[model samples]
Target: MSRSPSFSRPPPKQFNTRRPQPVAEVLKRTDAFAALRAGVEQIAALEKDLRQLLPDYLGSGVEPGFIKDGVLALFAAHNALAARLRHLEPRLLSDLQQRGWAVNALRIRVRPQAVKEPPPVKQARMTPVGADALHALSESLAPSPLQAALARMAARHLRNREPKK
Candidate 1:
């Protein structure tokens, strides 16, 4: 004998009773990760200060790196940006010193940035008015390949507008 299909509701899902811990808290609980996190935060703070000191146009292409023995490293996205950074090194060093950063010198490094392609442009959709116009034009034209092509285009667009059952 054939059996009938059952449509009863499934059992309830069981979730954990304990509350989730925040990422920062978890990182702080670990030894190695805590040190790494501290270093990353320090760099972020330095970058913020550097951004404030730099001109608006130059700030975006340059980033602050680690400071070693009173020398601060600056990474640039391109060679031209690196050259510009080098030209402004003395001013940047003096500004950083005035800000109590303990920076005595600036070293600029060229790090090529990855090129990103822009998003593809969307194709314009065919409106019912345009499709109707094409249909009328196709009707007015003589029986030729061009007329057939126009009729096909109009039909395709009009058919797309029809509601499906």
Candidate 2:
């Protein structure tokens, strides 16, 4: 005949004399959570102040997007405005940091704009020379003996063509 397996007796439970702590009390006991809450509250206040401080020309209607990595993204109508904002970024970031925003950087993006083409330049016209002028110059410049013969021939031709006056 097989014997039944024996089990060990369980330990006795102790009753708590004190009441359970409240959720608020528990959260307060954790320093990390408290610091996180304070940081979030400060960030909210800083965001509100920043919204009011931004210029109206930067588009008062749209809200600026804030990144968790401490980068602030803003949109500009064109490259000129974006460049202007980039120039002032250092000061803007410093101001935000002073207000406890903890911003690491600011980025401005330009929206597409129509580009204008420059006007065309006008050029001067070139004058044309006659072939008769070129031939006369060539005949006058013929070498020594040839030059003399051409000159005599030209003189005779001119004499024959003269009027009987």
Candidate 3:
């Protein structure tokens, strides 16, 4: 006793292959891609606005990098500016989060740019000493009465040991 076949005479073949499609063509029709572009533009605009409104606190110049997991990384000019921004991190994070930016944290880092010129070097003057200058110094260093008495005794002792002049 055998059952009769319904329709197919053989099993279907399976092919593991993917037809390559241009990325630009695929993105053109994606709503999610469009939303991503819009979000990027919005973030850029917000960053620009922040730069204009909070120049002192944010820094003279700021470059916004990737935003991930509600955190935004920004590049400042120097450590001083970064430190200032970090000091106000809580307020800045709150403000940005309030603006629906999903900014849970604000991290500021220093960006390397051009090196500044060092301050001018000061030249020191070197005065030459002459015999007259030495004489003036010797006069200024002349001994007091007690010192002169001691020096006279030393001179007398030395002269006594010397051959007659």
RMSD of each: 13.0, 28.5, 21.9
Of the candidates shown, which would achieve the greatest TM-score relative to the real structure? 1
Model 3 TM-score on a 0 to 1 scale? 0.44
- Against the correct fold, how does model 2 do in TM-score? 0.35
- Residue-level lDDT of model 2, residues 42-143, one tens digit each, is 555655765666676643332345555888776666777777777778877888788767689887776654566877785532222333333355486946
**On residues 72-133, what C-alpha lDDT tens digit does candidate 1 reach at each position?**
88999999989888888888888888888878888899888899899899765799999999
In order of listing, the candidates' clash counts read 0, 0, 0
Off by over 4 Å in 2: 1-48, 51-56, 59-63, 111-165
- Arranged by lDDT, best first: 1, 3, 2
Give the Cα RMSD of candidate 1: 13.0
Error of model 3, residue 109, in angstroms: 1.7
Candidate 1 structure, TM-score to reference: 0.58
How far residue 65's Cα lies from its native spot in candidate 3, in Å, is 1.5
Off by over 4 Å in 3: 1-36, 115-165
lDDT of 1: 0.85
Which candidate leads the pack in lDDT? 1
lDDT of each: 0.85, 0.61, 0.65
lDDT of 3: 0.65
